[model samples]
Structures are given as structure tokens and as C-alpha cells.
Target: MKLVNLYPQKNIEFFTPDTSTKLKLPVVTNGISAGFPSPADDFLDSSINLNKALIRNKDATFYGRVKGDSMIDAGLSDGDLLIIDKSLEPKNGKIAVCFIDGEFTVKRIKIEKDVIWLIAENIKYKPIKVTIDNDFTIWGIVTYIIKSV
Candidate 1:
């Protein structure tokens, strides 16, 4: 288990989707079965533009690459690409990309009346209780996750 430093100083590497160029990819309308192998279809059902499909707010959307396994149990693994929308309102139980104490971290939001908690999906890490003393902000909400098989 070796780690590659994609961004030397950041836990999440951020990038904005280039909407100027639309790349349409063939889409399979039918669902692929996991239990058994299905016959391959030669014809594509339709084509989809990833930029249009994934991004709802082009101005506020950003792609963040996961750097650690803090949220692995939440299905956000290391090296996974996350679609973040800054315009979305922050709410309880929503997974968010947060900037805390000069560093960025992705965690599940836990709003408790006056207090807020940044929870890690993996048990190895502990839940962070955010107080007024800390410089924290919910940068964006994680809308989608892109994983490589």
C-alpha cells in the first residue's frame, strides 16, 4: 500500500470541468447485470455529454480528487474523483468538502442545533466537532463520485 502524492500540500486536488468543449460518449441505456454476464450489444443506445450530465451549476462545480481513505466507508475511496457543487445549500447528513483550520477535508455533515460535526466514514478516524474557535467552512457538497474499476 504505497501512496502517490498527486497534490503535495492538499488532501483533495481541485479542478474545474471545461464546459467549452463537449465530449459526447456512447451510453448503454440497459443496465449491466452483476450476478451474471450479459450478452454484449454492438449498438449504443445514445450519446451523452459528461459536462452537461454531471454539472448542474457550471460556475460552482468543481472536480476534487480524493487523497486519503478517511471516507472510504462512505464509498469515497482514495484516488476517487468527486463532483462538488458549491452552490448547494449545506444540510445535515450531507457529505461535504470542508475547509478547516487552513486545510481541506471531505466529511459527512452533522448539524446538532448549535454545534456542527465533521464525521469520518472510516472508524479509524474520529469525528471532528467544529466550534466557533475554528476557521471552518463547508466549501461544497459532494454530488457525485467517479471511481475506476
Candidate 2:
């Protein structure tokens, strides 16, 4: 399957609060600058060319950097960038990026009648079972793998 871009279209500005002076200072822009405003502005609203900023196609995708070796057997190594698509419905035996307890994790999803299992491709990691008590959310389905050359 192809990858999809899911980055938010809104522009986010970072600022630091000065407790001593009770003033707020603009810090930086998380997005790439298009030779426009500096980071010290009070208000900045700019639009990005989504088609140019991301790989546009029929599939929906977002970029994420891999953190561990849990998916090494699937050719996904540490520090690899993954393109995830939230629009696609996840099915049995699909690799998905899931959110559990406010943290993000990538794993192969296994659906049973009454059980949902998050399986890692590598043997070093153990599978996580989603129970009724745990807060679980499947963030997106992985569509493509992007890595640094």
C-alpha cells in the first residue's frame, strides 16, 4: 500500500513565558520557514503548500521516526521514518501506529473475537494485549516505510 501525509495544516507558534517579567516571548516555528516571518512576531499565520511539503497521492500518510528495534524483523529499524495513514481502516495482521497511555507505538495489529493484540515483529519484544481497563487508541495504519540512505 502507498503512504499518506497526515500532518496538521494549522500553523503552531511556540512561545516562552517569562515569570519574572510576566511577558511572553516567541520562541520558534516548528514548521519550515518559507522565507517569510521571523520567530519574534506576535502573530503569524501562514499557509504551506501541502502538495509540496508532503508526498501527495491517493493514500493518506504521515511521517514518524521509529524509536526502537521492535519492528526490526519487518525491515523497520531504529530511527526510520514511517508513513502512516489514518484514513485507512486497520484489519487483521496489519502494521499500525497505536496510542496507549498517551504514548505512541508501532506494532502489528492482531484482531480476535474478544481480544486485540499488538504484536511486534522482533522476538525481543513481547505482544501487548488490549484489555477493557486500558486506554487504547489505534492512531493510524502504516502504509509505507521511509528510511534514510
Which is the leading candidate under lDDT? 1
* Candidate 2 local lDDT, residue 86: 73
RMSD of 2: 14.4
Q: Tens digits of per-residue lDDT for model 1 on 67-147? A: 899999999999898989999999999999999998999999999999999999999999999999999999999999999
> Model 1: which ten-residue window has the lowest total lDDT?
1-10
Model 2: lDDT equals 0.68
Per-candidate TM equals: 0.89, 0.61
lDDT (tens digit, per residue) of candidate 2 on 1-149: 22333333312111111122323333334654779865744454454443333344323445676877999999888878766667778899999988776567889999999989999999999999999888899877876776777
On TM-score, the candidate that comes out on top is 1
User: What is the lDDT, from 0 to 100, of the residue 71 in candidate 2?
Assistant: 92
Q: Give lDDT for model 1.
A: 0.89
lDDT of candidates 1 onward, in order: 0.89, 0.68
